[model samples]
Target: MSIIQINLTIAQMLDYTMPILFAALCGVLSESAGVVNIGLDGIMRFGAFFGLLGAFFSHSPWIGLLFGIAIGCLVGALHAFITIRWNGDQTVSGVAINVIAVGLMTYLLEYVFSTTGYSPQIQNYFGAQAYRVHLPFLAKIPLLGAFSNLSFMIWFGFICTVLMHVLLYHTVLGLRIRTCGENPKAATTLGINVFRIRWFAVIVGAALAGIGGATLSISSFSGFSDSMPNGVGFIGLAAMIFGKWTPFGALGAALLFGTGQIVQSIIAVTGIAPKLAPGLTLILPYVLTLAVLAGFVGKSIAPAADGLPYYKEQR
Candidate 1:
């Protein structure tokens, strides 16, 4: 491939990587606090639709982002109430949230947009050239050309990865969160409020997942579709496992999966997809996800107290 094609491919890879990176980050934060959130997909769906709804009516992607974050927090609170407050099964709560998101978003899509597939498009948004950042000097530098013109969300994803690393490893709060996940009982003896910490982590993580979802509707595309987010959330969980739950690790894993996605597209665009069996090319990313997980999941370990409910009053 030409240098220009390589650069464009890298750019597309970054675009595809954003949502998965964010989802993996969500998993990291929540599971780090002893919560296993399998509902990342549902949260993304909620964020995608509500984000588009906000942008469609307000004509501002920023406002749409807030809407997505708000819904994420709301749903996160519900999950927290169930799993943390009531000591419910974490897996069940997450599955419930996912189910609710599917039906509720489907209904809302038809009720509001009067369509079953997609919402109205919002112009002059981040998906347009007017809002993308331009680094003219980077364009001529081979691989650096990928940064020449890109959406702000892509930059934000990178920034979030760094910040998440700092938050998880460098700060006191980070240590405490990890402590809660590793040993909630020990955390309680040390005066840490496990429930409160868990609540904060899950909600914040969900907000990030929401932003990931919103990125799809407002930045990656101009509007919300029934297939919005597709399976990006689940793939993110795979990335999380592949990365061993570290911010930078997730970033690398996300990039790998993103490259798979971009390659799939490149194959189709280059007419090589016709030579392949139908639907086989489309599963490239998912196949990559399974391969990574099968190779790494057994070796990677989760937090000791992860997915366990903490009932302080019982002991």
Candidate 2:
């Protein structure tokens, strides 16, 4: 309704968009390199759970963040091993990872903390409020300055997007990764180790998703919960698809979905139609995902060999 309110909404949108941004970037990287990572939800859940566990034990949120990243790498390697080394079905591997993660997190939460829904509030370090970025000079800039209060995760997400773009576009590693996805046989002929390249891409993607998950428990909120991600990882997949597998494109899709979330909150607060707000808010992202995909599905494309198991021909 006003300039201040709109700017504040956009600022909040940036924070809310971080999980999607990170996860979508992960999806883009993995899929661009010919691996389908439907397990985004699983590792995000792992990151949230383990991140809290690490902080709780060591009294350091930074350590928690590292734990999350490590788990992501392990999971990515496992997935890559299953698909790349073993030549297993990629979809089945991804789905299995998600299912395993759900069970693992559920069991750990109950057994370790004696809780079913969430973990105990992490303390001494992580229990502290997630840090925010405040630019002294920028904070004085009127309407836009209100946004300076966003979580540090929001800034991290933006930086990652730029970095991913550079990695996928400018680097020699980027070229090899793309070549592997497009034609592993050709890449192999060109002296690239196709399997290793795919493995590296998958691990890097998972590390990004780990940050996405950690943002939930360590940066956006104080502790982890069974439902910490709440479908943000899946939504990020949709964002990646909507973006046609590019970092900036995925970022735009994340912003669009984030706006939908912000609008949902606005509806509840504004009371334009109080009774319909909550349900509509809950369904907004899903509806948008389906609608956008349906509209653009025909035009959107994937890497030539995405989700296919690659096996080097015997000499």
Candidate 3:
């Protein structure tokens, strides 16, 4: 309603945007490298679960982050092995990974903690205080102050966004990756190892997704739950599509979706428009997704060889 209120809303939106931005960045990386990684949801779950496990056992959130990254890499490798090496359908493999993650997490939680649904509260979870920065003029501003006091992973996410953009556009490796995605046959002729690039992308993307999950469980919630990621992974995929596969574009799309999510929660809290508010708030992101897709009105171009397996031909 007021300027201050608007600023505060924007601040809150940024907070919600960080995690999705990280996840979408990961999606961009994998897709750009010719791997359609629909299993970001599973990778995120692995990160959240392992983050809690590591934090609980080691009594340090940093350890949880490291563990989450390790788990994510493992999951990524598995995905690569099945889809890339075995020539399994990428979409089916991704779905299988999601299902497996759900089952594995449930089983591990029950076996280790003897808890059925969730883990115990972590006392040493990551928080804003862990990454607080006091920018001179920025901190002095009312709503802008919130930006300076962001969580450590949120800062890392932003850095990763910039780094990914550079890596995707500037480096020789980036060219190779794009080449592989655009035409594996052509890339092979150029002596580029398509499989290797795809594998690298999958692992990198999974690692980022893991960080996003750790941000949720350790930094955002200070504990892990069964639904810790809460569909943020899928939201990230939508963001990737909406952004047309660019890092900065994905970040913008993520901000928009995150704003929708926060607005939904705020409206529910305010109890304004009661019945319609709930449905509208819940469906807002998808509705906006559809609108964006419609308005863009272009052939949605994925990697030319995306979702396809590469096999060396017999001479």
Worst 10 residues of 3 by lDDT: 127-136
Pairs that collide in candidate 2 are none
Which ranges of candidate 2 are over 4 A from the true structure?
Answer: 1-8, 123-130, 277-298
TM-score of each: 0.94, 0.91, 0.91
Off by over 4 Å in 3: 1-11, 134-137, 268-276, 294-299
In candidate 1, stretches whose alpha carbon ends up further than 4 angstroms from where it belongs are: 269-274, 278-298, 313-315
- Give per-residue CA lDDT, model 2, range 61-112, as digits (tens): 8888899899889888888888888988888998998999888999999988
Which should have the higher TM-score, number 1 or number 2? 1
> Best by TM-score, which number?
1
Candidate 3 lDDT tens digits, 1-315: 554555566666766777688789888999898889888998899998998889899988889999989988999999889988888988998999889988998889889999877788887876745444445576567777666555677677778999998999999998888888888888889898888999999998888888888877887777778876788988888888888888998888888888887876556556665655455675766766666767754534567777777886822
Ranked by TM-score, top first: 1, 2, 3
The digit string of per-residue lDDT tens for model 1 on 8-94 reads 887888888999999999999999999999999999999989988888898888898899899888888888899999999999998
RMSD of each: 2.0, 2.5, 2.5
Clashes of 3: 0
lDDT of 3: 0.81
Query: Where's the lowest-lDDT run of ten residues in candidate 2?
Result: 123-132
